[model samples]
Target: EDQVTQSPEALRLQEGESSSLNCSYTVSGLRGLFWYRQDPGKGPEFLFTLYSAGEEKEKERLKATLTKKESFLHITAPKPEDSATYLCAVQGVTGFQKLVFGTGTRLLVSP
Candidate 1:
């Protein structure tokens, strides 16, 4: 079975503090790794997609990196507005291409 685990469950940061959130996975065959940011009541918002090891994507204060077994979401100098539930999902080489998602990391940035 494909599985995903996100660390720390929750994180607290001060404005301008930087940290990285982890997403570890085990799959039969990796198709893609995805990152998402979700607010309290809204659905997840797509952030990045990594298809192969060593691939990386960046947007504003967030950077996403992928390795063979895990991915990381690096947040640099975060602000209060950057606080959200960060999600990690993976797609394997199955017929349905279903996505296995982690519980997510809740990030709270206080000014």
Candidate 2:
């Protein structure tokens, strides 16, 4: 069976604070890991795609890194505008790469 879990389902940060969100998973055959950011009532916005262990990607204040069993999203100096629900998803090496998504981490950055 495949499963995904994210920790600290919600986080509150003051402006300029930094934190890391974790995404843990168990799967049969790993193909890729994906990170997305979703604003209220909106579809997810693609952030990164990690293919293998030691792979990493970054944009602006966000950095995503992957391991064999988990992945992390590191936010640097977060701002109030960065408040959103961050989602993690995994794709297996079986059949069209179907994705399994974790309950998102709701981040609140207050000014």
Tens-digit per-residue lDDT, 11-110, candidate 2: 9999999999999999888888899999999999999999899998999999999999899999999999999999999988775778899999999999
What is the per-residue lDDT of model 1 for residues 1-111, given as tens digits with 9 covering 90 to 100? 899999879999999999999999999899999999999999999999999999999999999999999999999999999999999999999847788999999999999
Considering only N, C-alpha and C atoms within 3 Å, which residue pairs clash in candidate 2?
A: none
lDDT of 2: 0.93
Candidate 1: what lDDT? Answer: 0.95
Give Cα-based local distance difference scores for all models.
0.95, 0.93
Worst 10 residues of 2 by lDDT: 90-99
| Model 2 stretches with alpha carbons more than 4 Å out | none
Report the number of the highest-TM-score candidate. Answer: 1
